[model samples]
Target: MGREDFERMARAGFIERNGTVVGDYDPRLLELLRAMDLAADLPELWDLFDLMKAVPLLVVRGEHSRLFSRETVATMKARHAAMEAVEVGGQGHAPFLETAGLPEKILEFAQRFASSVRAEAPSS
Candidate 1:
């Protein structure tokens, strides 16, 4: 959403009252925006998955995200047969990790992967 829309939402109590909306331009944020703008033209590196074939991959996408589409997730799964994917419901663009149970999911995934690794490790 744009700044104006975000401000309107904040005024209407849609966003948290404690949160600060950038009512004025911040110079530091401008630098961040400039960097993001420059990074936008970078080429997609989906093929980099080839190097991560041995790594445990977990792909979490917002259910309504335009950036990470279902097709992309499907292709990721097809390319990395072991990749696990999950979509957080009722979120757009990016999921709110604090409210989306993402931390718990990540912990579960890490624990499961760690267990598998331990099981496969040779006993000294």
Candidate 2:
């Protein structure tokens, strides 16, 4: 499923023009390996979901990403009622890698979350 989507994106000129660099061959191998490494080498880091209880949580989603299902987002929102989810336009699973302007959206979300945190705190 993932491969098919990636192939489609490549054909649509989403990747590099040079075969290895972009729309040529299997480019998603690198991202897949990185995710695998994170899951395998830092299994404990996955538990950060619980640690989010002590900090502000912002959930960023790419509008087209199959990686995050609506049910998962709902569960996260239920877990952290204060959490905010923002979806970026014209993007898929790895928006940062696949689309432009996603970084700007991420920055904007961070800024908004920070301001909200400061606004809600009691005065010293």
Candidate 3:
């Protein structure tokens, strides 16, 4: 996003400023002028999602995330059966995991998966 775009989004309360996010963001399409600062190259990964369908998936989604839309979440669930998805209210992409009860829920999910995995026997 250019300076003008960031300024516009900030003015509209879409982007965060000073560590505070305004709730209830309506997803809007924006022109991609260039690659993200943190990303080197953006590769298509829908096939990867199909390839990993057998693996368990726990999706934490922001209700208003434009990048990861609700349709995407639904598509992921349709592609995978052993999937658990949690949507955070009034948040955008990569919602703050420190939000109420999120940390505990993540820990619980980890423990559940950890106990379910069987350890391989050592071949001494």
Among the numbered candidates, top lDDT falls to 1
Q: Per-prediction TM-score, please?
A: 0.65, 0.48, 0.60
* lDDT scores in order: 0.78, 0.69, 0.74
Q: At residue 121, what lDDT does model 3 achieve?
A: 40
Off by over 4 Å in 2: 1-47, 97-105, 112-124
Best-to-worst lDDT order: 1, 3, 2
User: lDDT tens digits, residues 47-100, model 3?
Assistant: 988988766678999887999998988888888878889998877776767774
- Candidate number with the higher TM-score (2 or 3): 3
Q: In terms of TM-score, which candidate is strongest?
A: 1
**Residues 35-112 of candidate 2: C-alpha lDDT, one tens digit per residue:** 675545445433567668767777767777899876778888777777777776656675553345556766887898
lDDT of 1: 0.78
Error of 3 at 68 (Å): 0.8
List, residue by residue over 17-103, the lDDT tens digit for candidate 1: 357544343458767667676646777787786778789999989898998899989988988999999898876666656557889
By the lDDT metric, which is better: model 1 or model 3? Answer: 1
Question: Candidate 2 lDDT (Cα, whole model)?
Answer: 0.69
- Cα miss at 5, model 2 (Å)? 14
